[model samples]
Target chain A: MSSSSSGNVGIVIVSHSSKIAEGAADMVRQMVGNAVPLAWTGGDTDGGLGTNVAGILEAIEAAWSTAGVAILVDLGGAETNSEMAVEMLAEDRRARVVVCNAPVVEGAVIAATESSGGSSLAAVKRSAEEFYA
Target chain B: MHNVNASRAANAFAPLTASAVLVNAVGLHARPSVKLTQCAKGFAAKIEFALAPDGPWTDAKSPVKVMRVKAPQGATLHFRVAGPDGKAALAAVLALVHDGFGEA
Candidate 1:
């Protein structure tokens, strides 16, 4: 990883469909380039319309950084699974990860932009949540 | 390049203002809105955008808010920027719009 991308909050997109997760990740990439670490996970292990806790955990790790990680979910299941994934993290890592309550796609894009600008994890989460406010 | 009309406020605390036409084919769609907000965040100014001269202004630094503006092609984008870097913020935003967000 380049030094510029370090310290920026990471982002994870969680959705019931893999396509939606990937699509939101694509938008974040297009807008922020490689300025922030980003990852996405969706669908069950069976490749159906559901979210997986293990997969979400892996995504959180893939996009992990010391600055922190913000997860955006598509629906209730995605959110529940995301919370479980966070719970599975090591105690220290758990504190740095949060499942935000915001629209999946829009929240991911806005969160990634805030992350790219070197905002704190809380600030990024607040920016994404602004959509719902 | 699009024409930009910039003016300073009579009150020192008042925000600097500018207007520029969205010349890009898709106007302030997803991509352009992201670019605008990203550009706006680079400065220390508190920037707002409105479709009208006196609006219903939206925070220019929030991607979601800016995207919600949905300013269409040829629509005028009015900006009100306040802060220490207000002048620079207004100039950068106007330049981005005039450049059609590099999509023209």
Candidate 2:
């Protein structure tokens, strides 16, 4: 949320399980402190194990930054839903949000660390995606 | 004898280097790894870390790679640094490790 002032890229973690989403967020906070804007969303509208596009959209809004936002998803469903959420944003905003293909927890941690260092949105996404490479 | 001479020659051109024992309780876990990488990124010098004198070094500025090192407490972290500020970078990293990443 405060990332707008910092001008650092924001991050959103999406997972099927609420616990995993929150836990990954906790790890990112512990490592990166409050330097990077971060948010997480998981589970379905009914609080079941699933991905919700609306929740992901709200999280993107909560963690939005002019610098851009990087989203990390745990599975196929989460990735697809995150893409949908990005599409729902205005065309200008949609271009700045990216769903990275990397391990969720590790990617979030690395991405947050890079963002804390005043890295650009593209750099942040690259750092997160580097986990797979 | 030839091998020993070759090793000596290699050392003659070695980059700036330093080593410090990890004194923290948990070693290079998430928190310390993040701290280490952050510090390394602040300097322009290229830095690498290895658990042994001859090792598979990992990029010190990459948090994910540094975390993968997983150097345990009491493990000696050997660093190889290059660039104009190599000395300063090595000192800063050594200081961070010597301070136990503020965890000890």
Which candidate gets the maximum DockQ versus the true structure? 2
lDDT minimum window of 10 residues, candidate 1 chain B: B1-10
Over A100-131, each residue of candidate 1 has an lDDT whose tens digit, in order, gives: 98899989988988887778999999999989
Which of the CAPRI classes, incorrect, acceptable, medium or high, describes model 2?
Answer: medium
Predicted candidate 1 versus true structure: per-residue lDDT over B1-104, tens digit per residue: 11133224313446778899999999999889878877887887778889998877788888878888889999999998877788988999999999999886
Per-residue alpha-carbon lDDT of candidate 2 for residues A1-133, written as tens digits (9 for 90 to 100): 2433358899999999999999999999887889888999999999999999999999999999999999999988999999999999999999999999889999999999888877889988888888778
Q: Which residue ranges in model 2 land beyond 4 Å of their true spot?
A: A1-5, B1-14
**TM, every model:** 0.88, 0.86
Residue clash pairs of candidate 1: none
- State the lDDT at A50 in candidate 1: 98
Assess candidate 2 and give its lDDT.
Answer: 0.88
CA shift of B72, model 2, Å: 1.8
